[model samples]
Target chain A: MSRLFRSVSLGLFLCLGLLLISWWNLFAWSVVPVSGADVLHAFTSFNDQTIAHRIVLDLRLPRLLTALLVGACLASAGAIMQGLTRNPLAAPSVLGVNAGAALGMALVSTLPFLYGALSTSIAAMLGGGVAWLLVMLLGSTWRVGANEHGRLVLAGVAISALCAALTKAVVIMEEDQAAGVMTWLAGSLADARWQTWQAFWPVALISLIGALLIAPSLNVLQLGEDNARNLGINLLRSKLLGSLLVLMLVGAAISAVGSIGFVGLIVPHIARLMFGQDFRLCLPVAMIIGALLVTLADTLSRAVTYPMETPAGAILALIGAPFFIYLVRKRTL
Target chain B: MSLSAHQLSVGYHGHTIVKKMDLTLPDGRFIALLGPNGCGKSTLLKCFARILPAMSGEAHWQGQNLHHYPSKQLAKELALLPQTQPIPEGIKVKDLVAYGRSPYTGFWGKLSTQDHQIVEQMMKQTGTYELRDQLVSELSGGQRQRVWLAMVLAQDTPYLLLDEPTTYMDINHQVELMHQLQALNKQGKTIITVLHDINQAARYCDHLVVMKAGELKYQGSPEDVLTSTMLKEVFSLNAQIHRDPVSGTPMCVVED
Candidate 1:
């Protein structure tokens, strides 16, 4: 009972922290300078003519909302991947999703005719789906069991390498079109608008709910494959649904912000430390923490350069790279 | 109301372990599958539990194909405690035990009041109630074993299969586990286990099934299966058989 109380309190604290940061993000280091009240007036009373209210309504609000959803999606996807693979290091970046999406974005942004044919987000989704499919097939999880977790990770690494190389080649070849790809590749929320949020939220929300619904099966999976099967989990079905959910989440986030890395990797371990291993509890807490971290990073990004915008994803990678090293050395894990 | 394997050839990959074997396991009895190393006793138990698919034959339960039952329905009827489990990180004993009721729980795995009662009862029966709030990873080997058993018991299956349930325990813990399993079997569960200890199996288990190199060597009551010649033929050991002073069942005394 005390643990439950503690979890609830911690959850409440994280939520409160997210709100506090969101407020800070609205007014802090704004190029057009808006106050908290101006931010509020944009929501309560709309004035298209006033620049402050217009900046708040048209730019900052959508960015804030997008950051929240993006953070939530990535962290949940990380937690799900970790659970499904039974590898502590499993994340969208490590498992080829991010690289594959980057490759898709690179191809679309650089190849003149192909770039115009499809939205980068849809292309990203398709590419991630294909990469994950290849990883799953190479892992041969169906004929054998999921005991080949190590093999799956190896396959992901190889695919990520290939995709990264292809993306680099695309960027180098099309120097003129590379400017847009470069900023997007850094994973900035600077260009976020209401239209982006409108396209991103519905899919992100459905995938979030899907992640929550599968939490129980993922819990059983933690017991290992043989035991999971004994516990009534259809291993292939659970894994298929889990991977699909991950692609949906990661595809949406990468498309929205241009391949934000490390939030997916770092947030899940923090959530597990705070809330224990039950995904039902852990994923929600991870979502809040992810949101909190991204909002904080976004807030700090403006202040970091003071009037010049910095990509929130770059700031996250700054923290995430060192954390990854720490996780690699944390043998007890 | 029966569990049997019909020409069940179970194995991993293409290598057949238990090849085209037929066996009818009697219901409502304490049974043990005993064999030398590589004999496939463990493989056979896994087949009956439906954890492994039979390569070329069928496992039948209650007059129907065991493979045909939906996994949830199968889970409600049978439970397996594998020889080795990687202790789940950060799972509380009570929560792990509650997972045993997954077949009966909602999609979110919320236990009903009756499920709570069953989980409570299982913890008590396995003598792990005191460790309810404690982490499974932090428990001692004996306590961890009992906690896992509590989870399996919470599954509330009449058919239980355990693969080498006492691999890492000290003699005292091994004996204690045997006693606990006997008590559970007394409640009318069809308890089937793969055991390494010949003397332990003979002393506690009412029925014995012996296998050697994937073939059924001998099976009957302890009196019928524990003869010195059977041990020599099946186990490749020249061992003498004598009555156990306590249970009066045949016990093996390996020749020096």
Candidate 2:
């Protein structure tokens, strides 16, 4: 009964929070006062008569939706990865997927030939795939026992560093393209159009669904590989499917918002602390918390400096880094 | 035809651990595998549980090869309790036991009424019902071991393989666990355990397989296998084997 109450209350809270962000982004426009008629017009039709309607519908709505989707994707991916690996610190940033995506973007920006033909979304997916492939390869090669959490972590660190170096090399060669590279790397939702939403929405939705579907298997996996196998879970299959889900979530998220860090790392931990570690509950709770955090962060980024916007990624780091340190010190991790 | 291994050779990587060992497990019997550390008892049990691929041999459950059956099907026939490690921080005892029902669950893995009933019955049988809602990490060593046992029982298998179930347990807990295993065997569940204590193994097991240096030193009833010479040969110790007062099973006392 308490579990039901808690879940319902969490659902209510998530709905309220999402509504609040949606209202702030829609009903309240900064450059111009958005009257009810303008808001109605924005929803009913798109036109040049009301510049406010154009900004709200064309500009802000997609950005807000992107934030919510990307945030949920990263957080859900992080939760699944942590559960599958039985490690608290598992996230896309720590696992080298973000760095790999950045590398892919950097390469695309530098090479005019590739940038002219290939889309950023495809390039980002390729980069994430390569990074995960390397991690898996290195993981298999270690003489240490399979499913050693520490080995995967170490391999992630090595791969991330290598990717970072390659990104730096690209940056050095193409100093003229610094502005475009810097904006993407720092991550901004400033230009999130309908096209961007269309590109990533299906990928993120499928991955989230996949993650939730495998939540039960992850519960079994947390008992450790031997015990999970004894319980008839094919450990290799579970691990592979779990990794694929992570790749889709992280890959699509990075492509949309350019490597938003710490949402995956911190939101899942917060959800675990609030709800117990059962993935059945944690996955959805993590998704809601993630969407709330990013939406709130984006709102704050817009509100704090009014005219000059702050990056949502930077705000999350500023807030999340200290909270993460507190969790480490408290040993609640 | 209950459970047996034929010419079973087990290994890790390229190195062989147990070589061409053949053994049969009697149904509804309490069996113990006794060996010094690194004698491959754990490895052999892993082979029996199908956690490790046999290097070159066959393990049969009933008359069928264990490898030929699906993992879920095998899980319904035999369950294993591995050496207990730290439980994840906030898993409730009931949930932990429910993991044992993984093989029987659907894709969504909701606990059916029958699964819940069996889980409750297993908890009650093992005296862990009181700790059902408590997090596993909060339990004492002995209590935790009982919870693990309950989990294995929840698998609803006829045969159970336990690897050093009492490794970190206190003496009282060890005795309690042994009694529980005895009770389980009495209820027609076959139990195979690797035990470090020769006297305890002798006291509880109906059959004993003594191992040394990746080879079986002896296999028979406790009375046939628990000689002072066998003890010195396999365990490298001085001991005297005597009959227990209560159970009349062989009891070993090391001579100082």
Candidate 3:
């Protein structure tokens, strides 16, 4: 209980610190750099016609929220995926959910009428659902019982490759839509509008709540299917519900900020390493750590090449890959 | 009856391993299921545990169909210890055993006072109370088996089904485990175990259910079931069956 309190307090502090940093970054480095005082004034005076206030309120705050939501959603999704599949490498991107969402967005851009943010979001969700279904089907079919973890990884890799190729094909054919999607595909928070946050928070909240609700089952599932079954866990229900929750999370994240990679892949592992392997602790800690990591990455993306934004995905991958390699070598997973 | 199966056929996809079989296990008896490899003893046990769907018929505990009972309800009544389960890493023995209270606990999986008491009781009963704080991954095979059995016992079910519960244990630990199970059985819990060792089954089990090629060959007291003729027919081996002076139970010695 003290450990739980300590971890929770630690997560809360980190999140609070990250929140301040995110808020400060929103105003400090933008098209027009605004002072912290002005940023504060902007929050106090919402109706202020000052350009700095408008920039802080209308532009950066929403983007910051979007990044935080994406980070939390993707990270939680990855953690849940890792738990369900019992595979350390499992994540939204690795399992092809993000790529499927990207493909969905690409396909939606092809349609002459369904080009709105909502339509694209729905399309991405459907695509993610399809990909999740495919991965599950493949995972189950190729499952050799003992080597199921390996099979799941293989299926994820195969589906991710397939979806990436198809998304590329779509991008290559549509030159007009390419520019709009290019930054998104690389995973940027630049286009995060208020509407994006409006659409995103609900999905993120629902998935987080869903993750908490099913965390007990996930913990049991880590014991393997037979033990979980004897312990009264409905394996099919947990798997299906978990998959659906992950799909929603990955779909919402991709729809909001394109496909931010590695946050989903590494945040869960980091959380587990810091806090124990129990999903009850890991899930919530992963959320806070995920939010911090992406917000930090976004800050780095803004600052690293001042006046020119670097994609957050690239930044996350730079950090995540080395950590992943370290974890693999250490076999901590 | 504690548990029974009627016209039960269990198998893998598109293949029936255990044909239409009927079994009624008497209440509070320590029973052992003995059969040759691939003779469907495991499959039958799995079917009873509701891990596998019955290919044709139904299984029941008390008066309710096993399938009809909610998973938690069934879990409260029956606990199955499979032959092998992948041990999760970084889990303390106490935490792993606490999972047995999942049927009774709420969504958060917090152990109430009673739940904690039961968990402690089970750990003590299985001789794993001292190892409660140790990581499951760090335990030896016998220690691990006992811990797993502790988890099963923590399930607090009236009926326990174990598939080769003593597989990884040495003779000493195996006998200790058998004695622990005997204590549990004496406390009114019905235990149905599938064993590879005929002698061990005969010594420990009050009743024997022998199978050959997915069919029940004999079901009775060990003295009636462990006869030389039955052994020859079921195991396809000529064996001398003699009572041991110690326990006076039937012992099989294979003839060259």
In candidate 3, stretches whose alpha carbon ends up further than 4 angstroms from where it belongs are A1-5, A45-47, A113-118, A141-147, A330-333
Q: How well does candidate 1 score on lDDT at residue A224?
A: 84
Selected candidate, larger DockQ, 2 vs 3: 3
Q: List, in the given order, the native-contact fraction of each candidate.
A: 0.84, 0.81, 0.88
TM-score of the A-chain for all models? 0.93, 0.89, 0.92
Candidate 2 collision pairs: none
DockQ of each: 0.77, 0.75, 0.89
Where does candidate 1 chain A have its weakest 10-residue lDDT segment? Answer: A141-150
- Model 3 error, position A293 (Å): 1.0
Cα error, candidate 2, residue B38 (Å): 1.4
Q: Which candidate ranks first by TM-score, i.e. highest? A: 3
- Name the weakest run of 10 consecutive residues (lDDT summed) in model 3 chain A: A141-150
Rank the models by lDDT, top first. Answer: 1, 3, 2
Q: What is the TM-score of chain B in candidate 2?
A: 0.94
lDDT tens per residue, model 1, B1-256: 6789898899998889998898999999999999999899988988887778889889898878887878998899899998888778888999999999999998889889999999999999888999999999999988898899899989999899999999999998899889988988898888999999999999999999999889998989999889989988997889998888887888899997
What is the clash count of model 1?
A: 0
**Model 1: per-residue Cα lDDT over A60-110, one tens digit each:** 889999999999999999999999888887889877899898898789878
DockQ of 1: 0.77
Per-residue lDDT tens digits for candidate 2, residues A1-333, read 989898788778877977777667665436566765676678888688778888788878898899899889989988987887777777887778888988987888687777756667667767877986797578662232466656776788899999989988888888998777777777777667899999989989998999999999898888877788889887778888988888889878888888788888898998888887888888988998898888888877776787678788888889877875665476543
Question: Candidate 3 lDDT, tens digit per residue, A1-333?
Answer: 998698878877877887787876687557686888787888886656788889888988898888888888999999998888888888888777888888899888865555664577788888888887798788783242554655666787799899889988887787888887777889988778998899789878888899888888999999888898899998788888998899888888888888888888898888888888889888988988888888888888887787888888889889988876775676543
Q: Compose the digit string of candidate 3's lDDT tens values, residues B1-256.
A: 5688888888887799998888888889999999899999999999898878887888877777787778888889899999987878889999999999999998889889999999999899888999999999999988999889999899999999999988888999999989988999999999999999999999999999998888888999999999889987988889998888799999999989
